[model samples]
Target: MRVLFFSNPLVAHLLPQFPLARALRGQGHTVAFSTAEVMAPWLAPEGFELLLSGPSAEEVTDEVARRTGADILFSPTSQLVGAYFAGARVDLSLDEALAAARYWEPDLILHEHLDFVGPLVAAVLKLPSAAVATDPALEPDVTEALTAAARTRCLERGLELPSRVPSGRWLLDLCPPSLERRGALSPRERIALRPEPHEGPAGPTRARRAPVGDRPRVLVGLPHAAGATAGLGPVLRSLGTLDVDLVATTPGDPGEGPGLEPGRVELLPFTPAAELLENVSAVVHHGGSGSTFAAAARGIPAVVVPGSEAQQRQAEPLAAAGAGLVLPPGRQDPASVTTAVGRLLADPGFTVAAHRVRDEIAAMPSAVQVAEWLVASVSARRGR
Candidate 1:
């Protein structure tokens, strides 16, 4: 079977779908990607054929901002969602994606849940599709908003919106059961898959860092996006005071700050957090789904400093599960970060809880299993 994977122009959105795609390819199926040109550099090295679609991420963001009269780069969840799908961002890509789908003639499309064009293309082609959730905070309200926007687009294009506009034939849940979204009955079939770590192409091999010593090692992973580093200086200063070796992953320089010890802190450009989690005792991050699940898979506790309401929503469940702590919005000062890291380091309960979640993640079906299931399901549907 030929499988096509679709995602928004963001690395975070694309990474979660790779493991399953790889597994499908291992089973002798053809796998290709449909995304914007900006992602071509990252996808080409993975050996997947690319069918480029849509405008660059910058163009999309600028258009959304212009239409919604709000800067989409830093907008809140509701505003960003409204501006992205309700605006012409999704529509801009729809035609290219549909053209690619028709040419590729994929039997199935596995799409990140947030990318609306994938489902629309699948519906138009009458092909089965699966919505892969990259984050844990897939609220019903958000789904409804995206669905409504997609329906309007469908009507405008003279295409009929499938009964399942937001969700596809399957909803791929990667979140641990404890962190899964509640309070909504999804209209599609829910299939749980273990969250596998797949960071973009590792540039080049470097000498591995020395193994952890007596001091605890912590990873601070702030988003690479512009302005995501705001207020991060204070957090780093707070973390420096503790007797721990710190490794921070940033896109550019993480300028020097008050308490930063050069010898104890190492700043590198965009290494996969999953690779770093193996040697770390805990993680402090912006609570992206990739970062959260990477730490969870390694049984590392985290201090989630969310930059948006959507991130905060995802972080709350980890705190509730005892695997992490959520640094309150207005209180993300140096003092608060210090206290949270201290708790994660000094308490045994957090470690125990993290290990439990790790075990649960391990128990979930592997990518190969999910790949087989997909093939079987598609065969059954065709037989019917």
Candidate 2:
């Protein structure tokens, strides 16, 4: 079977799909990724074919501003977020996406939750598409808004809109039981798939991790999205005061951030979360699902300083589950973050909760199993 993983230009959304891609490829199925040209460098290391379509996030944001005068990053509402992804993104990306999909002739299109272009391609081709749900689409109202915006874009493209959000078809859920939002999907339509942290290079193992230092190693990774940087500099400075060695991520020059003595803080660019999580005691991140799940999967407690509502959404459930702590903008400070990390390192309960989540994730269907299910589901649906 041939599978095409589809998303807009967001790396976080696309990251969850990689495990399944690995599974399918291992089983001798063809796999490719479809997105803008900007994502080529990101996915190149994975060695998947890039169908390459659509505009960069900046271009989409620009189009949204020109069309609706809405700045999605600054003040994001459901309607504007819908416009950013479903409205402007669809309008700008549909033609190229259609061309790209036509050339690839994929047997199935697995799209990220917020992406509409893939389903549109499926609709145009009369093919089956399922959602690789990264985040829980908890709000039916927000889904409706996305559907409405997609409807406008579809009409403009002389195509029909999908009947329900996600096209209300098969949903491959990555969320665990405790962190799942209320009323996200019907049991009949939702398929549980285990979530794994994005793996990077084969680095040190748990046994090999002793060389760094006897002191606890804490990872401080904020999301790379625009406006998702909150308390990164201050949090780093505070953590430096503690007895823990730090691992922080930087998209640009590692030399550009807050200065700490050499070997005190390690700044990495594009190191896999799996590699970084190894031997780490706890995590401090922007509460992105990518980071939260990575830490939880390894039973590492976390301190979440959210930079966006989406990040905040991930933080709330984690704190509720006792796996982590949340520091909103009002409460986020050098001292608060330091105390949270310190508490996480010292508290046994948090480790217990983190282990609970890890076990729960382990109990979910593995990516290989889900890949089989995806192929069977699509094959049956298409009568192939």
Best by TM-score: 1
- Supply the TM-score for candidate 2: 0.91
Error of 2 at 126 (Å): 1.1
Model 2: per-residue lDDT, tens digit, 1-384? Answer: 888888889788888888999899989999998899999886887788898888999899888888888787777778887888888888778889889889889888889888888888888887778888787544666777787888887787687766767663688888888888676543448888888988742333323345366888998887776543444677788888888888888776666556776677777776778888877888988777788778888888899988776677757889999999999888877798899999998888998999999999999999999999888877787775
Q: Report the lDDT of model 2 for residue 181.
A: 68
> Model 2: residues >4 Å from true position, as ranges?
138-141, 155-163, 184-188, 201-213, 224-231, 256-262, 382-384
Per-model TM-score, in order, reads 0.93, 0.91
RMSD of candidate 2 to the truth, in angstroms, is 2.8
Candidate 1, superposed: residue stretches over 4 Å from native: 77-80, 139-141, 162-165, 184-187, 199-204, 227-231, 253-262
Residue 45 alpha-carbon offset, candidate 2, angstroms: 2.1
Per-residue error (Å), model 2, residue 333: 0.6
lDDT of each: 0.81, 0.81
Error of 2 at 353 (Å): 0.7
> CA shift at 37, candidate 2, in angstroms?
0.9
lDDT of 1 at 17: 87
Report the Cα lDDT for candidate 1.
0.81
Looking at model 1, the pairs that clash are none
